[model samples]
Target: IVLAPVSLAAEDPLPSWRDGPGKAAIVEFVARVTRQDSAGYVEPHERIATFDNDGTLWSEQPLYFQAYYALDRIRDMAADHPEWKEREPYRSALAGDVKGLAAQGKGPVVEMLVAAHANVTTEAFTRSVAHWLATARHPRTGRLFTEMVYQPMLELLEYLRANDFKVFIVSGGGIDFIRVFSHERYGVPPEQVVGTTGGARFELRDGIPVVVKTGDISLIDDKAGKPVGIWRHIGRRPIFAAGNSDGDLQMLQYTTVARNEDDTTPRLGLIVHHTDGEREFEYDRESAVGRLDRALDMAPEQGWLVVDMKRDWRRVFPVAGS
Candidate 1:
């Protein structure tokens, strides 16, 4: 039988990715799962894919974007609370000393987050995050935080969606905060976002029912909690999962390695290794935020595909106008 010549433009789904093991793995996996006659073929509904937000989908270096938002919120509210100027974390945060604030450890950091984000109505908080995202720019890149997303991963998300996979953001960031931009930035809807959450209470004010943020921590959504969050939110096991740090280890394991006796579907787990200091930030294993040690150790034995950003990606962030 005569064969039609293939169009490289039509066949190549990930243009920003270099021709390497990482890119090839992704392409081969997608092809296998989408092929009708392949044993790895997955039904459209069963092709659920979960992605970690912070380091996997976007840049999380310097600090998580949500933390930056919290710092901004503190500054926005500083005039009302003069006492914060003398407080531990708030004082450091107000002075723009991220290092100092981090040095205070998790306790003080949590206090700052609660003070900035909690005690507002959910609607008001949503509006606050929207305003922050509209105006805030990353300190180093000077780009809007939403624009700092990995271009290759953006292509991956689009590619997955094109293959009829239902993509979801399973992040350790605040659910409400991420929901504001996930739809516009990643094409993942608010309903598909599962993240760390604070307690919320439903109340009636002015005869209108509304949800208000509470100071209580509801879910952490990192480390082992990732799987728990996935189970609680998506209800079905994802056939594919991608993440960047050790916090995402359990989610990767849950998606790719774990299996029930009755289930025999193919799975893919991907880890994005930040190795491009010039293009992005080179960090792993030692960084305070998005530490990747354990996950890196497990990737080889677990058969997870690790994408070395400096080597595997032709572009880190999207080029201007593209």
Candidate 2:
């Protein structure tokens, strides 16, 4: 029997993306920057691309996944601290009162986060997150948190990498939390992820060297902090960036908007507009989680491509086996 050879030419770089203005714009921008002869061509090392994690690359609705993980950790550790039963945040958290916990303020939230995330070895925290991602399901979707990653965005990540673009995940979520699954789920290694971080220090635990997480926060990589994180961690402006909400507005601006007429490097800013409630979600301006107000308003002026999920994605998620 003769084996038929596959035609590489027939393969689509972004199969999940529907053929439309949004997809076309992305393809054109990539081609322009990658082609050496093109006026918009960018050096390979400068072909950096960054993405926001939550609503941009996955479903953030109901609440952020990491928040759920933190809440679950707090609940699991409740038995050790009986005083938590009478505390403001812990009592609300223990009772699964999200609104009550929020009403308490950022102080309570930070206290809960530090309690749940700190005072432990980084390795142990990673293991715990891995375990939760494996067994815990989204309250609404019934899918594992990792499984909630968008199919279209996954394809976009791979596509960018294939075109010699170094992709990084710049999220507002916890750096350690996102690092646990970034590689396995998005093909982006841990070092390529930039997110909010808590402090840590090298220590000797049980006569073995380990990094212990401290309650102190080192960075909050969101909104204005997004650009600073990219500068400090990545040390290069991403030529391409994708995000879905106001939290990402500065990131989009930093990537595509020119500093001056003299600095005209080709750039592409993509916004994943959640307009498909039937398939995933439909939200903007008014929604609390991943709100898309300022960024949506600025897209036209910034020349950012806004991908309407309902119209531009043929597939919202990977099927049972795909």
Candidate 3:
């Protein structure tokens, strides 16, 4: 089987990243890494950058991707198990009444996650993820799940790569789930993605090595887990980081700490603040899913760039259908 070659050329593509502090920081970092005579000049292999998923790179409005996966799983598995039609959360999910389920609160949602996520073999889980991503559409927008990616972030990714940065997604979302479409959508291949993962075991299927998913859960990648996941998966510390909300606090902290160790090569951290209610949901300090309280408080003190989505993004989605 032949895979398309990954791109490793081109100039910094996001020169228009704006003239604010964020832009200046990024430009300075690039200059340092690229200068042959600079003490900060980093070899290409050392240029690691990590980004959090969810609201950081896409509109995680309405709900998270895992929630959507759970709903769809219930819907798909319901036909075989007729009892789900009468089950509490499953019933609501089957009826397309997510609000009703949410009204019942986290209990129902957790039940759904346990039922849909646990006890499956890793291969089965991957297959399930593939099936859902292939078929699912955003309820409100009616766009494919992969198509919901933020255009500006996509540009930033390309821009970073042009500057010799090796971009990786250290997200709380499932690794395989995001990997399914990230290569096509974000130009980030599956091998570079790291996220919260379920259990898996190796087996011999027809004398060939195969990975099976265990019903057991391993890690929940969120908040403090972000840095842990990055450390475990990528090994090398990132010189640049970007994320949204308090879930990304530890990641930003880790990146900033690296900057202090060596002043020669500047480290970069940016936070995406949800401020566009018309284009996407906007909330701070109190939203259940993507609460940004800690990040907002830390942004000023930490010198982390807080990106105002409304003010910064000229375009949100990719030309509606481009």
Candidate 4:
């Protein structure tokens, strides 16, 4: 049989990606599921795609953006609470010592986060996050946190949506915090964002019903919890899932790996490997935040695509002016 000549210009969906196996897999998969004549063609409603926010969708270092915001909040609130100066985690966070806080382990860190984030109404918290995101700049790149989003991923989101896929962000970050910027920056609406949630209460304040954030642990949407969050919020199993760390392993598995004997649907799992130290942060396995150890090892065995940032992406963030 004679083969038809393919037009590179006409077929390029992810233009920011260099020609490679990773990019080829994405294009081919999307085509196979979206093409009318293809056996794997899926209906629009079944085209659910979920992505992790930090590191996967945008930069998550020198630390997770939410953690940075929490630290900043703690510092801002320190003047009102002089006791923080004598406290272990608060003192370190106030001094801008991230390593010191990490040394104290997850307990102290969670305490600090709760102190900084809770006890406000949902609306108030949303506004606070909005203002912080608007003003806060990433120390390394000197770019606004929202501006640090990956351009290639932004294109991918648009590309997926164009193919009738509904994209959702399933992250370990705070749900409210991510909702504040996810819609405006990533095109993923607040309703489509599923993340770690803090306890909330309904209260009538001055005759207005308000939902207030309480200092209580709710869902920590990471690792095994990712799949649980997906079930609780999304209701439908995603056909495509992307993440950057071991924290996202369960999410990738839930989306791609077949479970029951009766289930048969094409799925894709992608892991974003941070390999570009020059343009961005290079980290995996040994890193404190966004560690990619278990997920990295499992990707090959599961047929998941691992995107090498330095090799696969033609560009990291969007152009300075653009």
Candidate 5:
């Protein structure tokens, strides 16, 4: 695929990045990077920015959408494994009782993930994601999964790229899941996505060492694990980070912490507050999936810019066919 050259024109590619503080901060950060005399003059190669995928780039509620996909896949695969009907989370998930399933918390979620995501070759898993996204519609929005991506966040991605920032998706969603469409949807190529990964093995199916199926569950990219994933995967601390939930706080923190490297710029951290229930669910203090409690309380102390989606974003989802 012929990728378009990154555009750095002053049109504000991310019209959704807001006009006030949130917008100002991003603009200032970009200006600093471009100014040769500025303390933040970062060479293009060192201009790395990391973004959380689910709540950061798009809505993660009513539950991690990827979990929903896993549940759906589990249900489909359960026909072959009738034992899943009696399994804890799978049973609850198949029964359409998400609240009950979540009550079991991260452990049950992990079990469901292993059951559904494991044992599938990387190629097969990618094919499954492509198939599901092409056909599945979000329960609330009734739009294709890819269509549910935030217009503003998508614009922010393009904006960063335009400024010579090497953008990556440091999401809790499956790396393979986001990689399938990250290029087409967000313009971040497959290699630029970092997320929870299932273990796979090299198999010579036809004399090729292609990654094959495995039953191993590796790291999950969320909460404190976000920093761990970043360190292990990207191997570079990001100078800019954005996320929308407590799950993303560590990631933002990891980015904003002062760096000792001479070439690295001081970081910019922005949090997306989901304050618009009219357009999207807006329960920060109580939501389970993308909880924003701690991030809200520490925003002022941390000097992090909090974006109230209801007030900041002029448009939410991308317009049809956009």
Candidate 6:
């Protein structure tokens, strides 16, 4: 009796990824940590993977899609606060001048949106975001912002989850904003997302309990804050971390850098390098949004795998309707 040969292609976990060092590295790391007989085996409960959302999992070009959301919100609010029509940032946002609004820096743009969210019921804010995501299309791609998420990363997330890894999103974008679509887009639930958070005030609104955004940020989950957010939200060091910019340097270090001499558990740190200008926008070290500078410089020293977008991903955005 003879048996038919098995197909390796049918078992390829990350089909969107090209056959290259970056994809091979991720597959190898997952195999090593999940194999119970391997020395690098990690318990399912301890397998935490944190990813930076914007450039790491999705496209962050022209401006962060969140910034675009905020800009649109500013325009919507202009009717309520007519003074905003003349206000600096508001004026630019009202004009749909993405470059002008981005020039104000991500911080100010973040603050602008949070301010709009201020004093509103959490339910209301969530609805507004949901509405925007449903209707708003990327300025360049003409696809909905959520449609721009990286297919390779989505496959990576699925691969990790199949191995029993708990994935969390740690980003500089608004926590409340990301929560609106995190589960639907990345299969990551709201609770697993940790990001720049605004202070909230709990109060009774017309016989019901409500939480209102106070326009006061409690944390900015980027750069050094990333590690702190991970600790505060997850309560444990991540075994794997992925990011795309200098903002992720500290988190990468926190994940891969050994705490002490005896800490020898296998760890992985990955950086998504935007090298494909034809399929995607390319900027690093010098670009304002999602700048990948020092992190790129130190990736080699840190044993981090820097994935070149042009070379590693067979496709960037998910195919429509897939």
> Which candidate leads the pack in TM-score?
6
Span of 10 residues, lowest total lDDT, candidate 2? 102-111
Query: lDDT of all the models against the reference?
Result: 0.87, 0.86, 0.76, 0.86, 0.80, 0.91
Q: Which residue pairs overlap in candidate 4's backbone?
A: none
Instruction: Compose the digit string of candidate 4's lDDT tens values, residues 117-235.
Output: 66689998888888988898888888888888888898899889989999999988878888998888888899999988788889999999999888786887888999999999989
Per-candidate TM-scores read 0.91, 0.93, 0.83, 0.92, 0.91, 0.95
Ranking by TM-score: 6, 2, 4, 1, 5, 3
> Per-residue lDDT tens digits of candidate 1, residues 1-322?
9899978657778989999888888889998999999988898999999999988899987877777887877887899899988988789889998877656643345446755666589889889889888889999999988889989999999999999999999987878889999998899999999988778889899999989888777777888988999999999899999999888899999999755775778899999999999999999988877889998998999999999999999999987534
lDDT of 2 at 284: 88
Q: What are the per-residue Cα lDDT tens digits for candidate 6 across 1-322?
A: 8898999647988988999888889989998999999999999999999999989999988898998888777766778898887776788888888778767766777788888888998999999999999999987889999999999999999999999999999999999999999999999999999999889999998889999999988988989999999999999999999999999999999999998998998999999999999998999988878899999999998899999999888999899755
RMSDs, each prediction? 3.2, 2.2, 5.6, 4.2, 4.2, 2.2
Q: Name the better of 3 and 6 by lDDT.
A: 6
State model 3's lDDT.
0.76
Q: Candidate 4: where is the Cα deviation over 4 Å?
A: 1-11, 82-88, 102-111
Clashing pairs in 6: none
Q: Which pairs clash in the backbone of model 2?
A: none
TM-score-superior candidate, 4 or 5: 4
- At residue 204, give the lDDT of candidate 4: 96
Error of 3 at 177 (Å): 0.7
What is the per-residue lDDT of model 2 for residues 55-160, given as tens digits with 9 covering 90 to 100?
A: 9888887667776776788888888889989987788878888667645543345446765667899999899989988899988778887888899899999988
